[model samples]
Target: MEERRRYRRLPIKLELEINSLFKQNNDIIKLNNKTIEVIDISKNGIGIMCSDNFPVNYYFNAKIEFDEERYFYCVVKIIRSSKQGNKYCLGCEFVGLADFLADKVDEYEELLNKSQIY
Candidate 1:
């Protein structure tokens, strides 16, 4: 069998405020509604570990609380999910993120770079 290729990820962590909604039957339940730690972030999306599993293609709004001076929102699309021991790892694509949020991502990336020096 051929080995599957994995996506290359950046080695950086960022704090994000995420609220995910999952549709159940005819109702919508909030699968995760709190602040989550973003393990890695890319131009297209981000990777986070949450407590529950959300269906692929589910849409959710993410509020990234970068610092005391910055906070922004983004529309995320669930890409892949996997259970790692007890926690669930979720990969999502940023469908439509606000300009302010995109700026925050850039700032957060810079902060991550600075943190590595210490």
Candidate 2:
């Protein structure tokens, strides 16, 4: 028998900024700066490809904009990371997300569904 994953993934294509900080719950941290391309995004979290290495237990703030009109801020915790060619794959769990950002994620998922990209 083959194992099946429980969580459903939605396709996302967006550019995001990662700014790591030493303190938690604060958006003032700027440990390392990098630009990552989001591969997938959900209400709970996001996955992206980056070139830098972020140590575990690191907390950071992310700014993602789907379009010129839509943008959001999220506090993210690095859950898992791996290297794929020249880019590193990162799975981050969202923290302290506001209702507005959650709504935007839902909207993006719905758009992906209608476009048949899921």
Candidate 3:
């Protein structure tokens, strides 16, 4: 398969908590407090492996905590999903990624890459 992503996906493990999943009417359909593992991330989207088969095209808010005070939050829409053994791998795109948030993700990716180089 060919690579279609605009941004490079930085391979890193980050814990994210699903705050809420919304419906078309903006009503919350699901509330998840469990932490999911973010397999990879980029400026446009993130890949996560979780236990639930989240509905494709569904919108939700996720909170990612890099460290003590560094937290990134965004509204993401599920673009693709596939089963991986006992888990489900989901590809989600940021609905409206802010410039500051994009910068934060970029910085984190650079730092993560730097640490892996040693």
* Cα lDDT listed for each candidate: 0.68, 0.74, 0.81
Could you arrange the candidates by TM-score from highest to lowest? 3, 2, 1
Runs in model 3 lying further than 4 Å from the true structure: none
Clashing pairs in 2: none
lDDT of 2: 0.74
Tens digits of per-residue lDDT for model 3 on 1-118? Answer: 9998799987767877776677677667665586678988888988999998888878888776667666687888999999999999999998888889888877887677788841
lDDT of 1 by residue, 44-74 (tens): 6778886767678776777655576866667
Q: Give candidate 2's error at residue 103 in angstroms.
A: 2.4
In candidate 2, clashing pairs total 0
- lDDT string for model 2 (13-43, tens) is 8776665545464435564557778888777
After superposition on all CA atoms, what RMSD does each candidate show versus the true structure? 4.6, 3.3, 2.0
Candidate with the greatest TM-score versus the true structure: 3
Shift of residue 76 alpha carbon in model 3, Å: 1.0
